[model samples]
Target: MNPKVSIIIPFYNCPYVDQAIESAINQTYPNIEIIVVDDGSTEFKEKLAPFQENIVYIRKENGGTATALNEGIRSATGEYIAWLSADDYFLPNKVAKQISFMMRENVEASFTNYNYMDETSQPIDHWTRPVFSNNDDVYRAFLNYNAINGCTVIIKKEVFEQAGYFNPNLRYTQDYEMWVRLLIEGYKIYYLDEELTKFRIHKESGTYKHQQAMQQEISIVENEYKPLLKEYIARNLE
Candidate 1:
């Protein structure tokens, strides 16, 4: 049987949520369960009405993206979990290709390169992530720069059971923090060189709004994991 992949889209007040939902619905992969967690949006219900029949919609009081994602994960019933941002969308073969790669390599977590798009969904640039041969390299790369895009990642459900969920307190760099934890816990993350997802860049996007905060949080996460990374490298070198 094809493994079920749960695509969790956590959004606050994105007007382009329909595009995101449509992307999930259009995946060529058969066994997919799309869960949309609305983080206290006021007017999206009407917009979501058409796709309501196709997706599992959950509304909650105002919370951060991490909280909304945790809610979706709690309700998810899939062997694998994937994340799609409200402003971003996936290619039709995104899920299929990732699943095939994961199964063939026997890996629990994997991420792909992505195309940077404008608010109108027109491609502007391509983000080609670095390839890591092992989990240690993933950790070191993350410490230097975040190569894993949250919207491009497809992780096994058990990896969360081992590494835990996103930190609810972290308003910025939540996904980065989770990646560090997963790498530290010995989860090997495979990188697919294909650009199977579209990452939209807009003024209202979180990255633009919380630029400074993200940098500060990334520094904190790096410091917190530096000692652990050193020990792992030393042991492996010996």
Candidate 2:
């Protein structure tokens, strides 16, 4: 059976969202729904007007990325759920290829290796594949998301729900927090060895301010998950 995939894109005020939308609308997989959550923007929200007919647009008040993702999740009607950040985009054949892998393996979730690009789509570095002690351990990989770019993951709807909605309070490390939660709730996640997604590291998006935002998010992550993963997420008070 061909799985229906919902590509939920949380759009903030970013100029790059247009490219991101086009990449989604042109997916090689036909059974896909493009849910673009406009996170309350006047200028950026209007940018999606050109593709309004092709994509499902949801307008919500500005909260955070997590809140926007939750909106997208509730509206998703696909067997598989994937998130593509507004400022980032996908490589052609991303949806088609990943969907095949998921069905072939019958895994709960799967992510791919990806490359980073600049504004002009210049190559950053061909990120080498990481040797995971547990290839199907998707939750553990999110603790240190080197296995795949968060954008590279196409999550199963059941696994996505088990993790619950994105934590609205976490502005920085919500993906990390939620993936760990999914593991605690017991979801099987795996990785694809191919580089199927294209991740753009622009100033507007990404965990750029990691030094400032990550520490606070780490506190939240530790508080919520330490009881569950004390070994993996123990506090380092050095």
Candidate 3:
């Protein structure tokens, strides 16, 4: 039996949400569920009317992306979880390719390369991620910089059960914090070399609008994970 994958998209008032929903609905992979959590957007529900029947829509009060994701995960019934931001999108074969790779490699968590696109979804450039020789190197690399983009990641449901959910308190680096926890708990993260996700960069993006706050959160998370990272590095050097 093919394992079911749940694609969770958390959105606020982004106008590109329909594009994201369409991307999820059109995936080549069978046995996939698409869930969109509307995180207290002031926009009218009419904006989602077109895709309402196609997606599992959940409405809740204003919460950060982390909370929205957690809510969506709680309602997910799939064995695997894929997170796609409302402003971004997945390629048609994304779920198929990532699921096949995970099954073939027997890994629980994985991410793929992605292209950076403009608000109109025009490709600006592709991210050339570093190649890791092994899982250990992948974790070590994350210690220095976050190499995993949440939108490109497909994680097994059990990984979240083990690592816990995203940090709801973290307004900026929630995904990064969760990735750090997953690595610390010995979860092996695989990177597929294919560009299967498109990340939209716009002026309204959280990374663009809250640059200083994001940096501060990153620093806090780095310091919190410092000791664990140092221990891993020390053991690797021995």
Best prediction by lDDT: 3
Task: Give the 10-residue window scoring lowest on summed lDDT in candidate 1.
Answer: 127-136
**Residue clash pairs of candidate 3:** none
Tens digit per residue, CA lDDT, model 2, 82-180: 999887788779999998988898777777777778877787885555645555454455555423467888987776565578789887777777767
Model 3 over residues 73-186: C-alpha lDDT tens digits?
Answer: 999999999999999999999999999999999999998888888988888865455666666676777768887889999999888877799998898799999988777766
Candidate 2: minimum summed lDDT over ten consecutive residues — where?
229-238
Position 122, candidate 2: lDDT: 81
Candidate 1, 24-132: lDDT as tens digits: 9999999999999999998666778899789998989977999999999989999999999999999999999999999998898899888889988887855444666
Each prediction's whole-model lDDT (CA) = 0.87, 0.77, 0.88
TM-score of each: 0.94, 0.87, 0.95
Compared to the true structure, candidate 2 yields what TM-score?
Answer: 0.87
**Candidate 1: Cα lDDT at 134:** 57
What ranges in model 1 sit over 4 Å off? Answer: 126-137
lDDT of 1 at 80: 97
Error of 2 at 8 (Å): 0.4
Candidates 1 and 2, the one with greater lDDT:
1
Q: Backbone clash tally for model 3? A: 0
Q: Which residue pairs in candidate 2 have backbone atoms (N, alpha carbon, C) closer than 3 angstroms, thus clashing?
A: none
- The prediction achieving the highest TM-score against the true structure is 3
